[model samples]
Target: MPKTQCTDGVVGAILASWRYDISGISPEMRRDYEQHLAECARCSARQRFHRSLDGALAVLTSLSALFFLFALSVLKHIKPLEHMAFKILGLDIYDMYHMLISAGVAGLCFSLIALALVLMATPAPSYLSGIAVERARLIEARLPERIRSIRLR
Candidate 1:
């Protein structure tokens, strides 16, 4: 497929330097970039791709943290792991259990930090919230008139 180019090179360069994120810019400065994005299909697609990447990173980090936490919980409650450590591996149960617990805790901490960094450094929060708001509006529009009236009240 042929590649599309940005309609405005100067504004496109600026947006590219900022990874197409205008959320951190002042409203006055953002207006021009926003207009460029709206008018240029190439830039708009690039912006969407960058935001989707940010959102994917946030989700992956979150899931990593949750999985680590789940691992810790399983280690704490399950006796089979202890038995496996002792019988199958021929290792000291207490030492192996402590090591696994420590690893799980460390992984959970690392993933949480990664998630925090992603949320802080990217426009993922605003982008995701915008999506949620749009979805809410669509759902509300589809609601029965009686329910909508009651909600308004």
Candidate 2:
């Protein structure tokens, strides 16, 4: 597609304010912006880039949640050295393990809430699903002819 600067600066600014997503707007109100996007390459490209960014943020937050959960699980399996702090080092930090456990649990909860917010506030799910569908089609195209035929039936 040929790159074209926005024809109307005011309309471009308005669309930018909405992040180029007019799905929540009334049909009548969205018509002009839709037309602009169809005619203006810059706004459409910006929309795609923003949606991809939202999808990437959602994915990152979900991965962060998983990592925190994994950290908590690993911490649960580790046994702290008992009595060694008091006898060998003469330090009475008996609550160290408990503190670490508390921190891990807190981090896990925070990450999960972040992930939930990302999923709720962004268009990431649909974007990610579209990506998955495209990937699946590409993989299917790479399959052998005989395997592909067996699946088609």
Best by TM-score: 1
Best by lDDT: 1
Query: lDDT for model 1, on a 0 to 1 scale?
Result: 0.91
Query: Can you write out model 1's per-residue Cα lDDT over 22-141, one digit (the tens) per residue?
Result: 999899998999999999999999999999999899999999999999999998889954475479768877778899999999999999999999999999999888889999999999
Worst 10 residues of 1 by lDDT: 80-89
- What are the TM-scores, per candidate, against the unseen true structure? 0.93, 0.79
Candidate 1 residue spans exceeding 4 A from truth = 80-85
Model 2 global lDDT (CA atoms, 0 to 1): 0.82
Misplaced by over 4 Å in model 2 are: 1-4, 25-35, 82-93
